[model samples]
Target chain A: MFDDRSPIYRQIADQIKDDVLRGVLAADEQVMSTNQYAAYYRINPATAAKAFQQLVDEGVIYKRRGVGMFVTAGAQARLRDGRRERFFAEVLEPMAAEARALGIAAADIVARIHQLIPGDSR
Target chain B: MITTSALQVRFGDTTALHPLDLDLPGERIYGLLGRNGAGKTTLLSVLAGFRKPSAGAVLFDGAPVFENVRSTSRICLIRDDGMVGDGTDNLRDVLDMAAMLRPAFDSGYAAELLDRFGLTRKQRLGALSRGQRSAFAIVVGLASRAPLTMFDEAHLGMDAANRQLFHDELLRDYLAHPRTFVLSTHLIEEQSPLFEQVLILHEGRLLLQSDLDELRERGVSVTGPAQVVDDFVYGLKVLSERTLGPTKQVTVFGGLDDERRALAGRYALELGPVAVQDLFIHLTGGVP
Candidate 1:
């Protein structure tokens, strides 16, 4: 499932976050135990546990003591808000740089975006 | 836990293993990687108390390993060619023998594994094919339930489906009963994901030991214009380099620091992550 060059735990953490952002994993829904995740992914349980621990530390997920992990309340909204800021910094910034290097004007970039995106989406 | 201090193995005039030390914690899966003649089998055998070290100390937990009944009982090393009994031995009797020798042996589990592998008790060990024998080794190794189980290419001749079954069964069994497992195999990429820690042996020496994830991050690949790539990797530990027209891809032995990353960014060079198999090849003299 993880094909990236990043650490497996980091890939898993990002995947969980993606799932949460896409509404595949709803807030307040319990996630699979690390062992179950490991068995499903065919990886070491320790790697899965590391990813879960990262989620728990970030408050994206919480433990219910005896029960398994669950997405924290408002975690989706919080994550989306955080990602919105990063998208502009990491993605838009590089795109703007590339456009400038290619001698494309800011207005032309906006025009191209308009041609690709629907008017109602704005 | 398993510990070794300056362990060495010598046969006749040649040294199979130089002085080496390893302290492995309990209940984690470790992947042992090396080319042939890298002393992988020698290391596994020593760890399992099957072969004596010519020099230095071997410890299982806190006790001496070689010939120590208490320590030896906790280990099970399955060699590809060595089963529990002679070739004429019936499969059923082999399980009985394993159950008798290993205190943690689970006959019920063994039978279940055998059934899943499509093997029966009526067949003699000699009558089974090579793949079947490997499957049988896996059955015994997993069912032995030894606290420290080592498989030296135990999946040697099995078909891909059977190998998949072995990995799946191993993961499930390990989840239920946690124990230290040392798997020595040439099938690096296929089995790399299942390891928590990785140990690479080279020239009978302990080359590197690290968390599997950390090891993955150690090797970095950069692809850019040939001239720029050549200038960029100057003085860096370059493991291997490939050139296609003007674009050159170089695999380096260490992570790129912030300065190096900035340099790559300035030139628009693509930085790619290295897989464990690629790193193994570069590190073990397997790649030209």
Candidate 2:
């Protein structure tokens, strides 16, 4: 659900990114044209274009001169890198802080991490 | 933030709204769009507290807004119809009254707008041209500086040049001090650029709410041989099409990949951007 609290373009960009992650949109695949998206969703075309432009700027999508936009060749990899860069603040830091707050020993946490690894039954 | 829930309004037998729900945030510009009699004016009036909803309520930051001084004073609705006064009053008196009542009013801006529109303060309301009256209302709108500003087709009487001036000034001022602005108009192509978000009403019902950019990318126009165009558009959501002799023009919605583009190009097909107005017509046209 979209709340009016944030700019709609940012939400649209986030949704497109989610679509990429889910493989609903594939690399080298064409993305929707701004006007189509606008009519489909009944939004202003400029806001829709802003979302696509954001994706293009981040190398997640690219435009062909006379043709429409396509998902970049390494869009998934680029998105992975972007996500990895934010992992600490977005995931690890909060988990670590919570673990520390629970008074779980560092050794125990390390052992748990090791046990959770695949093919590490021993 | 402004929130409306199950908001229904009726003007005698004409139902203006149909139990609609919407949430409008502060510090941004919104284009409220619809055809004539699409309830745009009625909706805006409810939001600005000019007219109360027959059923349902409007809340500004979790509080009722109708006749509520604290919230009402922060808003100004510049309607297409000139602002009404208690009784007969000259244009000069109305401006003076606005200066006295609206705490945020900018007299300098008001003067400048009047000068730009070739309007003199001494003219009586009954004596001004329709275009001149519209200009005066717009001047009040821009100068009011209300946090939540609503302009409901305020430039209907303006010529192209003056309309452009109003748009430019609106953007310049909005960029300098961001606020919640709701502009309801039918001229989508002419004023689409200034809209950060768009809310569309269809037959007094909420049809769509979306960003302008996304709407642009969701559709493409393809023109080529009828066979090739038909083949290319196959399985896509074709909004509209026209064919003449061997050529066919197809406007379709959905994402089209480079492979498809290449395939179409191989058949000598031409692909291009669809204008906002055309796209809107295709999407909101009578045919489902």
Candidate 3:
């Protein structure tokens, strides 16, 4: 189910981060063993193991020796912090640039955002 | 682990493999990619000791492989034609033979796998359909648990659903019992995910070998306005290209550096992942 453009392990790691960020994987929650993930995704167990290793290396998840891995206590916050750090350069700036190229004013974009979120303006 | 030194194979006047040195470390899955006549089968045959090399040595753990029971017993090569069994042999007898031949063979697992593939022990090998024979081949290959197991396209006659089951079982069994697996397949995209490392052969020479991701990074796709794409890819090795109206996409062989990537970003050009299958097609003289 993974593309060959990038390594499948990297994709799996990104998905794990996404799950944590979306609260689908709570802090301290036990995660699927590498075999389970591999079987579910139909990927090589080594690839699945590599993803788990990366997460463990990053302190995004921790292992329990004989038991399975569990999400780090503050992984969601840390993941959100990482995304927030990239929000401007990765997300908002691109949106702003695209809006500018489309001839939409900054104020107009702000108004649209407000309309969608309805008073979340800061 | 298996190693080959100055190994060469010939068929009458045709040279199937050139003098080459190679190593296959144990306990990992490897994908072998090549077009037809790429010497894939020849290479696998030599590894399995089915054919003696015309020149040089094939060794397992430093000992010779040809007629060396120590090495051959630990190596199993299941060819596409299900060469592991005689056509007249009953399914049960075939598995029994395997268990007797291969030291690590597990008959119970073979039975379980046969059931999964919907094959019965009473069927004669000659009476089953092509797909069924392939499924039986897979059963022997996996159940053998050879330290070095090679499946030369295990899904040859199976349908898509059966292929999926094969991949699933391969990975699951690999986790439970790790071993070295070399899978020579033309279905690159469908099967490459199961590979940690990939070996590509062209003609009789080793073209490339690397981690699958690193190999993938060797190629990239650049897409943008036709003019922008042309300008951005001026000096790069373009493998293929397509243009539709104002937009264009060019497949570049070598990857772009960070500076070029940032430059593409400035030009609003999109950098996409080139599928390994596409890379293989272009690398092997596309469409020829």
Candidate 4:
């Protein structure tokens, strides 16, 4: 089931992106048809179709004539790169701001990060 | 497409539905929400050709549907009162009648639904429980496969589990065979998510009709420090407000654009989606 934090279509798109990034849905693999997805999720068909259309627009999926949608070639790589670019702004910035509010220094946060991942410096 | 032109239905001295125009294009699901006596059923009855509007016309594809056999055959309306047939008739008898009448009736699908709902064809309608009768009505509605199918609180007597089954089956069938569906119900919270569009009625008048997503975007709750929340909601239509110590939650009726949302984010305000049921109650001034 979906939550109210965002639009359902956006959630659907994000879920598909997550699947692709995790290799659960490999590139060139056919995704469920919009109607199938809608029935499975118990959501409006139009809403599910909108999510598919968004994926299509973002080059994550493509339609073959008279056939269903399939993951675009290199979609996972493109998604990972996009997520990497957003990591600092979307994840780290908020964490850092919260740390500052709690009187935690940036160096201490970095030390904790190093402790969590002993081999990674970046 | 189904369109109504200034449609109004009056019985004796009381007006059931006020003059209003409505357009329902084919191949979509619509949720009709209204308080009791808000004309939801009246509007649906007019659309289904069960009653002729006193002042206006109900048209299907530009032809009047009142008493038109061809048009009525393509439209099906199932109400909560078990309007399909006599109470003594068996389930199999009803299905037989449906197959003879409905041009697109799917007997195999009906049989499947009957089994899924745990309804035996040998059971008499009169002897069945309230929930069983509702399940039978829903089965007929689904298997009828009419171009325009309307269910006016047809699942009222059903238990929660059976109701969920009915919703699942309805969606699956609809996806398999695309058609137009209008569902009028008081259980908006559970079923509103299935609707592509929503029609809200108040006091025999159409309150609003909009895409479900757009309507959801119209109302949002913003929570933060009292002053910041006040400033953010200033000059907006505030539907409800709550305060606890230094924090305040204000529900506003308007779209929040990116700039305003960013502003909320900067202020550390929590913005949450407003439930469609809450919006309906606030809009209609009805008690929850």
Q: Weakest 10 consecutive residues, lDDT, candidate 4 chain B?
A: B279-288
Give the DockQ-based CAPRI class for model 3.
medium
- Reference-based TM-score of each model: 0.94, 0.68, 0.94, 0.94
Q: Candidate 4 clashing pairs?
A: none
lDDT of 3 by residue, A3-122 (tens): 768768889999999999999999999999998998899887778888899999988999999999999999899888989999999999889879888999988888888999985758
Say which candidate scores most in lDDT: 1
In the order shown, the candidates' DockQ scores are: 0.65, 0.06, 0.72, 0.57
Question: Candidate 4 residues B154-217, lDDT tens each?
Answer: 9978999999998898898888899999999999878877899999989889999998878878
- The CA lDDT at B243 in model 4 is 97
Indicate which candidate wins on DockQ.
Answer: 3
- Give chain B TM-scores in order: 0.98, 0.90, 0.95, 0.94
lDDT of 3 by residue, B124-220 (tens): 9999898888988999999999999999987888999989889988988888899999999999989998898889999998888888877788788
Q: What share of the true interface contacts does each candidate keep?
A: 0.64, 0.13, 0.73, 0.44
lDDT of 4 by residue, A18-89 (tens): 999999999899999998898888889898989999999999999997899999999999999999999999
Off by over 4 Å in 3: A101-108, A119-121, B225-231
